[model samples]
Target: MVRLGNLVNAEGRAARAAIVDYGYRTGLLSGLAPEPRERQGAWLTPRRLAILKLIAQGQPDRKIATAVGCAPKAVTTAVHHILRNLRAEDRAHAVALDHQQGLLTQPLVPLPEHRPRRVFSALEAQLVEALAAGQTKLQIRTSQGLSAKTVSRLLTGAAAAAGVRPRRGYAALVDSAYRGRLLTARAVDRASAPCLPERQHQVLIGIAHGWSDEQIAHRLGLSTATVKTAARLLYGTLDVATRAQAVARGWDLRLLGAPRPATRATARPGAPSRAAA
Candidate 1:
């Protein structure tokens, strides 16, 4: 039997195919190869088919609009139109039909070779060291003249490469560490700064929220590549080693807010109810 780890390794060896294969297998992505749409006697327009492909990539309405250079509302209408025409239940079903028809290509899932481990880049290693010494996103961006978005991306990508995927509650830690680093980096020079668009800001925030580049781009009306670029800028600015750290920093700085403290504490007085902080 092929081990799952082995499959990931094999998949990782090939960039294009690996993303789909590993992403879907790891549950990071969905709808890689959906069932065929089974629509007959009616042909789909090239535009409709194109929209289906985008949907398969996890693009939302806004993303579809940007990709097609149309309004977000228009994209929504187009999607409904396509769904009606295909007579499919939803977008996934439409994609499945397109894939089976060979109108869209399906990427196969890759098997892992051995134990999955973290990967790091030279810059990421340096950033990790800087973070260990306490660096800040703004400071790094000022000194390096990189955008916050890029820095955030680098950190997250590094974390993923390091095989340390963040699950739940990792956000708090990442946010704290990120803010600490930002403060450290800031002491150097305050004047120089990178220009980060508002859209990019939202994208980075989404990344910190654990959204994928595709999802972020889709939600924010940007391209996946643009989303990725923002992430890269974020990491560069923070001088952090991974995305997790950037997110952690964002949280610490209230760039990403934590859950509001419990409005009411219902412990009995002096009964050793709750441990002292």
Candidate 2:
């Protein structure tokens, strides 16, 4: 119901992913997914599969480094390599790939009941909110004064508070935090300004969501002129002239979530490049 002029439905994507995960759990989705390349068996060495387990278990790079007897950066690099080997898009996708390949035998653990909302320090607040908003690791680090290692540390702390363990994995811990309210997602309007009126905040969020002015008007129950007028005020508040500039500034100020990635039907024909992830 809370649509900031149809802010990209990240929750919708998660739900679809959940359905796909269910299909995999029931041995019903493998045929639908891409068949594994022949080189896969050679690629997933024992070391790589072990690392994947640590990832699923919610261990961050630093902890993974400690356990794996490698540097934290090495853990990151190895994870990237593992993703390439599995032809996975992200950690969660990598988990699914491993399961389909018969490498990861254990099923995902069910989440426990909701816990009360937990208070966080300012940094923790920004990081968690950015993550929930689907901001990339790079976006968070560059905009919010956090490093990848620090992010990991914060995740571990939150996971511990939520009683998330290896059986539940890293993604499980994030889900648990959401259920327990240890993490909170920002309404695009939560990125509002002090000087702007409430309606203008909605307008700004709508703009950030890539809504046409008419669409914003329809969603907010206002005339198109009213929406345009509000957008003018929004531009003034942000000290920007165009819609694109306002959005760019919003991202810099941590007033907006991460931009969505471009969707593709297939991977490009080349080695997977390193990602911030």
Candidate 3:
């Protein structure tokens, strides 16, 4: 009898696991297994919450450290913890999630007035603004009298100044700077302009939501190579280099509207369903 009871318990456990796996893959389960028992903000301590607020304002690690009265390394560690806890892909995602979860209601302590550093040349600024505005490289080159090589170099510099890795490209730099409230009104205006057609915009949204290229291609009913080509072209037009950065830029620019509803599918145990894309 004891052995039979144990076998029954094992079967029950397996059944529960299967159900959860199904829910997760189908988008019925919104977060990871073992979801937080408490509210989302319950896990964050007061200091971590303060750091999150600073992060939302686009403060870099050093600045966050200064404002939080902690070492820069400590701030970095906390940020990583925050990301893991939030299950966010990156800083931009963390900020967005925080806002969605209503964790940004805490009053922010203003940092002291500091002189803003001039980081970009006038020409470089114009180029970045144009890039954010969805202008093609050729259009910018023709209007600004810049060679392709020069434009690339300037973009690299701009990316560095905005505290973004240069390889992430100019769109990421612009998005980061804009999030930090560093760009001018004209730059924001240009960046806010719509640049993608409907299908491409859907593709960008899928990418932003952490969908793999193959998964996106499958859901969109396009060939994998076509999806790859479209993604590449989308990246170039947005002036971003990495998929993660492209998502960040898309979110910052409001190019990705509300997330799509999750769909039911016969996806693999852990694979996301088409609607989740």
Candidate 4:
């Protein structure tokens, strides 16, 4: 679970950004490695980090150009320059690396006029305003006649200011998030991929409450299959098969909210036992 401190703490936020950047840079950092004091190719620079911050903010090349008073193509050119310096594949990857390096946590120090600034589109700009106003995607989509997917894209584009990829589709995002959690938990274990003990119990409780896979997946940024897989894994860990058994054992183990025996609902008829099985 990403606690508020994860974002609120300056050190934690920088570390997170750097980790993400590092993950994207995997298998792509050859020339970009840190050089010895005598050796030289290219290194991560403030200019690169600035570009990354803009990309994360969802600024388009044109807007970035305008903000920096450069040609629209200049934005792309600047990005390529930054990538070469960082030995990254693309803007996204560079931004991810920046996040991982904690380069973004520091206050924004404006560059000289020669440096570029980021720009946003009217629509994209509006989206951020709406989000800041606490608007929901459904509401924004309805009012703007934009598809939910578009709204999501816009949000991602906006949130990318810090370089995190806005989850693409709702389904994909759910799966990614689910997988992310499992991976995170596994990272903690190192020897095996394990679900967090606490999360497994919470998931079981949510399932017992008749929450749909989509709902759970959306809330957890996980896919339906991941949810089911995690459930199965939890069951295996608990020596149970059925949801009831899992829930029963989970509750007994105090892994879940107090069990509600009255809510002995069964899986919906015709629903497959395993996702994508």
Candidate 5:
């Protein structure tokens, strides 16, 4: 069979090396195990650079040493330092990262002509926005009341929809989302302080303090009906759907820094004793 013949003739590790060499360059594959994120604080020498270039070309230790005019043992030692300094997993990983980071401009292997584009479903798009909004998987789970397994599935599904490996493709997913217009550059800008009306501000502060609507009504010297109205207005102003969301959004928008503790020693008339919401 043609398939059998192709498998038999496969170049094995050389093919894999070529994939890593230009897969990211062509925008197809980002290796599942990413380069380690430790700072690249160590300096690289010219000899080490030559070794890395040869390694990227899928050369063996002997070839790398001969190309760099060094002993094969020295090539092995330089490799150890390259992995440490770049926080790379191995030679191929270093090659991928080198291309990704623009350390080595020209890949020895020819770049692929085209790469598969990343795509996202509608649900995945929404998840990307939530992630960009600073919600973590755990926070999303609790807020959305999703089971742990369901949360995992949804995140994994989102990654798949974006054509990335689940969990391991966090950076890739985010990058694709930005490229796809699911998240905006404006959202990356720092937000200005939120300005709410006086009544809404009081209600929001009370909510942040974990006070019930009844407690907020009594403390702010407003009727329960008025307190409810203010809370509704506060929610609208923050564009949040729930109290917890409002609190989080408040913190995000710089509206709620630290709680200004209750200053009045004297309780207002009809103020109920403090209790959590």
Candidate 6:
């Protein structure tokens, strides 16, 4: 029986190789191969691409508007268009997608000479380093001779400059540490294991389905504010700063069901169809 199984596997391999050889010869395989949609970077105009570059640099809408010689409202509109074109959920997701597509390889436009760079104070720098090292705020306060309010203020300021939520500073720091190979596997495990409640689980599933707070609230028979608060809490628990990241993490953890696969459109009865290879 084992010999028969091996022979069957060998036959399958031979058949696959034959199909591959035929595909290469006929030039049909390339046409049928799936490519990432992000490869179509030409869809964005120069101005829109410039805005995306600024966003990648963590520039606010106002800053981007000034850099692009447009009003804040115009920047907002451009961002919406960029998001829609990229099929991204938000600015952060758009920036991430741009990175994935290698769209930010070149500097889009030079920053204005008069623009001031964001600077962190010595204490704030220490706080950020401590947070990145996985130290608690209380521990940082004790070691740095600072009060809770001072630590909070400094951390908040740093998070704002970095374009991340204040509470997400620690997670961002952890992510940096992991990327830099400074964190041990055990430490990563500890940080990644966040305790989530049943309600939060449902909320995450709703988000995975692309439901807004108002929609989730209506479906769950809860107030919009309640759903919003739950989402915030969910973000904190998952150590993610954005809704897109939360949904991705949920999918990674198998907390949410797999997305439905896209189906090909049916051809009309009289239309010509390509022969199946």
- What's the number of clashes in each of the models? 49, 1, 1, 20, 0, 0
Please name the candidate that would achieve the greatest TM-score relative to the true structure.
Answer: 3
Please list all clashing residue pairs in model 5, or write none if there are none: none
Candidate 6 local lDDT, 186-213, one digit each (tens): 2125345665654466566565444567
Residue 53 displacement (Å), model 1: 32
Reference-based TM-score, model 2: 0.28
Inter-residue clash pairs, candidate 3: 263-275
Model 6 TM-score on a 0 to 1 scale = 0.28
For candidate 5, the TM-score is: 0.31
Q: Candidate 1: give its CA RMSD in angstroms.
A: 18.5
Give lDDT per model, in order: 0.49, 0.53, 0.55, 0.44, 0.55, 0.53
Error of 3 at 45 (Å): 28
Over 4 Å off in model 2, which ranges? 1-38, 106-277
Ordered list by TM-score, greatest first? 3, 5, 1, 6, 2, 4
* Candidates 3 and 5, the one with greater TM-score: 3
- TM values, all candidates: 0.30, 0.28, 0.33, 0.25, 0.31, 0.28
TM-score comparison, 5 vs 6, better candidate: 5
**Model 6 score (lDDT):** 0.53
| Residue 184's lDDT in candidate 2 | 38
Better candidate number, 2 or 5, judged by TM-score: 5
lDDT of residue 42 for candidate 1: 36
Cα lDDT for residue 137, candidate 3: 67
> Model 5, range 95-172, lDDT digits (tens) per residue?
777776666763222111111133344445555556656567677778778787887776676555444555331434
